[model samples]
Target: MTGYSALNMQQKQAIAQYLQSLPSLVELDRDDGVGLKRALGNYWGQFLPEEIDSV
Candidate 1:
């Protein structure tokens, strides 16, 4: 909660949205781990850019 406590509301919401975008733990276990990791990275990358733009 150290860094998390420092985040603004929009930043927090963006992170929440990113978490929502993630595959469930069960899904991740069932799928190709490497591929799912890559997709999660890409998803966060896309989310971050838009959040930055808004700032």
Candidate 2:
């Protein structure tokens, strides 16, 4: 995992919440999820599957 691990739990929680809430803000297709993952990686870093599972 990238900077995600470095972030405090609250920050991770915020990102998780934002990602979770995206479905309410806009229609989410598979590509949207992929794109979001990429964006998060670019902005933060890679995420381990277990780390993502926590989010």
Candidate 3:
């Protein structure tokens, strides 16, 4: 994952602004009922059925 230090000035500023906006966003309900295995399955979409269920 790209660290904050790797970002340029504009990217850092954008991240700062996004962070400032996060408070209101945080007020929203965040539950999506998904976990790592299911999320990976959705994102990858190519895991074998048995592989997805194995863990």
lDDT of 2 at 34: 88
lDDT of 3 by residue, 1-55 (tens): 3664576766655554554445457553334324333444453233223335555
* Model 1 lowest lDDT segment of ten: 43-52
Candidate 2 to truth, TM? 0.47
TM-score of each: 0.39, 0.47, 0.39
Residues 1-55 of candidate 1: C-alpha lDDT, one tens digit per residue: 6855788778866775666566663455545666656654665344454444563
Cα error of candidate 3 at position 49, Å: 50
| Residue 48 CA displacement from its true place in model 1, Å | 16
Best-to-worst lDDT order: 2, 1, 3
* TM-score ranking from best candidate downward: 2, 1, 3
Winner of 2 and 3 under lDDT: 2
Off by over 4 Å in 1: 24-27, 30-55
State the lDDT at 50 in candidate 3: 33
Which candidate gets the maximum lDDT versus the true structure? 2
- Model 2, position 9, has a per-residue lDDT of 68
